[model samples]
Target: MSGMEGPVLVVPGLNGSGPNHWQSWMEALIGARRVDQDDWTRPDIDLWSARVADAIVAQARPVWLVAHSFGCLASVVAVSRLADRIAGALLVAPASPDKFGITARIPDTPLPFPTVLAASRNDPWMKFMSAARWADRWGARLIDLGEAGHVNTESGHGAWPEGLELFRQLQASAPAMTGPLQD
Candidate 1:
């Protein structure tokens, strides 16, 4: 995972992160592009996954994902079909679409690549326990970052240095070495 160049797609939550948001800040810092979602504020789950798959296909090299909120679920839905194209993924403060104890729209299959699930203890949009369960199901490394509600601009993490460090850690993790990165 050390030397992979990428078109890392920063997938934001409902409404997506604006230019001042952390995802935008991170995208610039990493020399990558945003997903440029047509409409993330109210996406159909299957359509969202399709766009993610399309983004993965559009990349010239290995693509990494940095997903926030419900975008995390979209990325998860894509994991099965896009694993060959993805280098890894970093899921931050996943907001469950299934708030009523319904299963997520995404499949529970293990992603065939490196992944980190960063969960907050006090995110108003999500329950940490449910996030943990998803992490286990996806076989992602669960990082319990103490209460930083939603881990967004409102959470005092606008230019979060700690989150940057975690992203580095995710990059240092093992990548799927054998597969050819998708176009």
Candidate 2:
């Protein structure tokens, strides 16, 4: 979507995004960097967030996060300490913190930078209302995708153009980076 002002960090959920997954396609489409976790099968917020934070630190510019499912959770936590290094975030189909017994670990306060959260009405990972609650808590704009299960390749969302549009919108709304990069 034109020239991006910052690097796009694509963060995938459990087991990682496969070749057929939309995250993989978006990375190919935009040259986005993927945040690879050491153990994708395990959902550990601390470890996952550390990996995401490290990725952001490695970027030469502020980053825009495109995260899915459990990766959404990790990205949010990672940005908590590095908010100034972030341009914006597009979080999709976030897994429920309650499901992982990490609700207390996730911040209940508003996020520092612009963030958009897209959720499905019938996602098996999280209830719609629960997603709404978290969206409000994070002060993120929420987009409702009715009955779109998980919004993954298995749910028939490979090469999701609509999600790309949402990311573009978030990018447009993000504040422009200024001055020198923080150390």
Candidate 3:
């Protein structure tokens, strides 16, 4: 499993995952730990990235990141520093950094570990094409989830069984390359 033997880390977006959210449901089903950001509603990209790094280092076992919306941006930034410890990542419905008015530069460096980016065609946070472009830039396998709004609780994704399957896919597959796949 390489460094992929640890518990999954569930990272939520914006205001944090409510109890009824899919992320919360994932936490229970997969025994995943939520990266409890110090500030949830108002996020500082660097701070969130640091928190993710801290979470990865704190774990004795390997870690797989499950990040949704804005949390996806944070994970990508943190992975630049902690790629050695990551097994894989599942990024779902990433929000536009510009929309949130986050000034911190989103890293364009391709991630070292295996990653799957799931994009919803009808997501309000970002255009599907933009998300697909990001997936390509990050060297992640893109999964086009047609018309699934935001893929959040409000999007009627309380259980998100399909997402769970995608997460499992990441676990089963070995990283496609060693070190960063591309610049």
The 0-to-1 C-alpha lDDT of every candidate, in the order given, reads 0.80, 0.92, 0.86
| Residue pairs in clash, model 2 | none
Better structure of 2 and 3 per lDDT? 2
Q: Using Cα atoms with residue i matched to residue i, what is each candidate's TM-score against the true structure?
A: 0.90, 0.96, 0.90
Judge candidate 3 at residue 115 and give its lDDT: 89
lDDT of 1 at 15: 86
As a whole number from 0 to 100, the lDDT of residue 37 in candidate 1 is: 70
Scored by TM-score, the top model is: 2
TM-score sort, best first: 2, 3, 1
The alpha-carbon deviation from the true structure for residue 36 of candidate 1, after best TM-score superposition, in angstroms, is 2.0
| Candidate 3 lDDT, 87-168, residue by residue in tens | 8999999998888676357877688878899999999999999998889889999999999999988989998889999888
Tens-digit per-residue lDDT, 122-168, candidate 2:
99999999999999999999999999999999999889999999999
Ranking 1 against 2 by lDDT, winner: 2
Better of 1 and 2 by TM-score: 2
Steric overlap count per candidate = 1, 0, 0
lDDT per residue for candidate 1 within 1-183, as digits (tens), equals: 373556678888788887777888888887766765787667667777778888888876678899998788778887677677788889999987675243545678788888899999999878999889889988899999988899888877777777778887777775534444533
Tell me the lDDT of candidate 2.
0.92
Worst 10 residues of 2 by lDDT: 174-183
Give lDDT for model 1. 0.80
